[model samples]
Each structure stands twice: as structure tokens, then as C-alpha cells.
Target: MSEKEAETPGKRTRPGPRKVTPKYLENAALFYLQRFATSAANLRRVLMRKVERSARFHGTDPAEGAQWVDALIARFVASQLLDDALYAESRAQSLRRRGASGRTIALSLRQKGVEGEIIDTAMAAADEAEEKPELAAAARLARKRRLGPWRAAEGRREARERDLAALARAGFSYDVALAVIDAEGPADLEGEGSL
Candidate 1:
């Protein structure tokens, strides 16, 4: 082996990330927004992480990066490119469709840095969009996990308590869990037009 190649370790050291600038932060934010719906705070968090990484590797000032992030976020919000209310509502609906209870959806939105008021509004919207939203969500969960009515006849009776527990753990109330778990069949859940 050549002395230059042999002198190096088996693994090559990758270059550090580029120093964060306003333009770089803007580009990163735009790219992120293009792929995922996010609240202003969540987007800020993502961009700040990039800033922090660059600061650690390139000795850049995080405070400067933070200022850039703040300005970029403000600009996006002003342009209506970042709408927390819309994000929360859309996310709540999507989560509900995937069997997430209202409580679960609220918690998820909170973790994403959405305000409580906005989460409440979003949840109300979700509720208005469906009758007995919790029950519907529970039903969807049961169907997806093959619990309760979706289970085979032979084992359903034996797994009754387990099915209820699963729904309970998924942020469903006891009443909702029982209703879904004790359902006679998938058709029973659809009686309320919730399915």
C-alpha cells in the first residue's frame, strides 16, 4: 500500500458541516417544510438542531444561528407558509383516521410544540367531523390490531380482557374501549355511522 493510504486509518474522517448562515438556515427550513407539515416552533427546533450541530463542529456561534432561525420563522409565518392552526387541524384529522384518540392526538400535537388553544380547536374540529370520535377511533384501532370484533371467533372470547386493555393503553376511555371490544361484529360499530 502507498504510504499516504497506509498512514490513514481504515475509516476516513468526514468533513464538518458547513458553518450556518442566514441563507443556509432559510434553505434548510424550506426543504423541511416542503417534505413535512410542521408548526413554527417545531420548525424552529429542527433548524436550531442544525445550528447546534454546526456550532459544535465548526465553532460557530449558536446565538447568531438562533437569531437567523427566529427571523426565518417570522418570515415564513408572515407569508402564511407556516400556519400552526392549519397544521394542528390537519394532523389531528390524519391521526384520528389512523386510530389515534383525541387525547393521543392532543398529546402528539403538544409534543410538536403546538399551543394548547390551537390543539383544543383542532380537536373540536375533529370531533365535529365525526360522531363519537373516540368510539370511532377505538373501532379503527380494534380493526387494525385484529382485536375484539375483528378477531377470530375461536379466540375472541379468551382475549376479551386483553383487547380492552390494548385499547385502554391507546388513550381510550373505559367506556369507549368496552364498546369497541364488546362489539358483536364490525357491522355493529358502523351502526352509528362511524365505522
Candidate 2:
């Protein structure tokens, strides 16, 4: 197209790049950010979706969508709206309170994208604050399942093996389960039991 045609109103043949409106982006970011503390990755995904959807509806470019996510995250960090370390700690503590083992808590946090070191550190902190429950906790769990503290002089070796196996499957250490089994005797609802 000639310069004269380009300058003429409605004569241009090409569409220029569109500018992403700052106000629209700001509103989109605030909309989701208000829901709760969110991770950078999750925020990005949500923003990307919203941008794409809006762009389609309004004849806007999808690339403009990325700007809002970065803007939102920077604001969140500056305002202390998002902190992975704090998130990890809170999640770790919550899991522990529900009777989850240290290993379980660590793995769950890791699955949520927490770094291994952070998970380990949080778990260590939790351990100090909440010492491991005595073998009794494990025993109580075993007993609840009717696995038992095996009788000292009661059933066949096979019955004893079954009790030992059950305890091990419950995630209790061999030592904890055995000690409890020895003290309480294996369950034998039908009189056939183990020590």
C-alpha cells in the first residue's frame, strides 16, 4: 500500500498490532488473586485461559494474555500475598495433625510442588514440635483393625505371622508393631491366635 493510501482513513490493507489494555489485565489478575494465595504456575494457567477467552470474544491477540500473569505475581510477592515456604509449612503441619506419618507428609508436600529440601526442613521442624507418638499410637491403630497385640502363649506360628504381616502393612515400623503385638496378644475372634 502507498503512504498516501495508508494515511487515508479506512484505506490501510494491513491490521496493526493491538495493544493490551492495562485496566482489563489489572481487573483479571485481581479477580483470581482475591480467591486465595496461588502459586505462580497456577496463576499463569488461569490468566492464560482468561486472556485467550477474552481475546477470542473481543478480537484481541492471545499473546497479550501473558502480561497480566507476570504483573499479578510481582504484585503478590511484593505484598507478601504468596510465599511457598509458608505454604509448605502450613500444609506440612496440617497433614501431621491428621495422623499422617512424617514420610507421608513429606511425599504429599512434594506432590504439591514443594522442594524436597523445604519439605524435609518443615518435617524436621514438625518433628521437634510434635515428638513421634509412642508405640501405643501404632498399637492402637493395629488393635483398631483387630490385628492385635498377640497373646504371649496362645496361637500357632502361622497366626503369629499373619498378625506381624498385618502390622507391617499398616505402615508401622516392625519394632513398634512387634512390641505392641507381644504386649497385647494377636486377635483371635475365633480362638486361633498368636503371640
Candidate 3:
């Protein structure tokens, strides 16, 4: 093999990211959107990372790439292909079902680049969709993790404090955690016509 093509032990060479252009950014954005839901700010960050990589490898002007990103984001928002509110609401609901606390959900949405106002709205919508959302979420978490009342009677006493701590770390309030941990059985929580 030629010296240039020769491989170092335990190392493999791969091509750098493609050069950034308006069309390239648009295509990348569309491809990304098709595969995952994202907020506009998150999408901007993703596109900008590509621009930075291209700037490094191809000497592309980052300022020009950023302008293209701004225009692309604006177009996507106009087309309703990128909706932060919708993304936040859907993500919040999914997380709630998996036992995420309200605070956890809000923090998660923020990390995804959703605005605080939009996060609040999404959280409110999630709460409206369920009665006692926090309680339900805590119960779901207890059941999934086999904590609290879900544990076998023989072990429940010994594991009570640990179970409460788990719920606490999962973002449940003391009252909610205590309620779930002190329940008689799963039926007590789920039989109230809420899951």
C-alpha cells in the first residue's frame, strides 16, 4: 500500500465533514428533521457545528455559513417544520409517562433549547391532560423500578428509605414520594382510574 493509504495500528482514517454551503445546510437540516424532532435553537446549534467543521477543514467563512443557517431556520419556522412548543409538549408527555417529575420535564426541555414560556405552556398542557400528574408520574416510576409498594412484603420494610430516596432523586416531592412508598399495593395507585 502507498504510504498515504497505509493505516496506523488501531487507527482508521475517515473523511472530514462536507463543506458548508446554503444548499448543504438546508439538506442537512431537512435530513435531520426527518429523523428527529428538534427545537429551532437546537437545530441552529446543529447546523452551526457543521459550519464550524467546514470552516476548519475547507476554509469556509463561518459568518457566511451562519447567515445561511439563519435564513434556513427562518424558512423552516415559516413552513411550520420546526415548532418548539409542539416539540416540548410531546417530549414532556413522553417523559411524564416514564415517571419524570414536572421539574425534570422543564429542565429537560430547557436543555433541548426550548424557551421558558414554551416549557411552561407545555407543562401546563401535560398537567391538564392528567389528573394529579405528579402523583401518577411518581407511581409509574415506583412500579417501573419495583420500589415502594411494588416490592415484596418481606423486603418492603428494609427498602422503604431507599425507595423514597430513589423517588426523591427522580424529582418527586416528599409528599408524593411518601404517598407512593406508603401505598398498600399497585391497585391503590392505579385503581383510582389513573395510570
Q: Over the stretch 58-163, how does candidate 3's per-residue lDDT look in tens digits?
A: 9999999999999999999999999999999999988988889998999989988999999999999988867789999999989899998889999999999999
Q: Please tell me which model should have the higher lDDT, number 1 or number 2.
A: 1
Per-residue lDDT for 1-195 in model 1, tens only? 567767986967567887899998899899999999999999999999999999999999999999999999999999999999999999999999889988899999999999999999999997787768899889988999999999999999999999999999999999999999998999999864356
- Those runs of model 3 whose alpha carbons end farther than 4 Å from true positions after fitting are 1-12, 191-193
Clashing pairs in 3: none
lDDT of 2 by residue, 1-195 (tens): 677886887864655333446576666667766875545555666667767766766777676557656776678767877666777777766655544455566666766566787777777766555334424345545545555543334553547677767767655677766776665344422132111
Q: What's model 3's TM-score?
A: 0.92
In model 2, the runs with Cα more than 4 Å from the true position are 1-38, 42-62, 133-195
Candidate 1 has an lDDT of 0.92
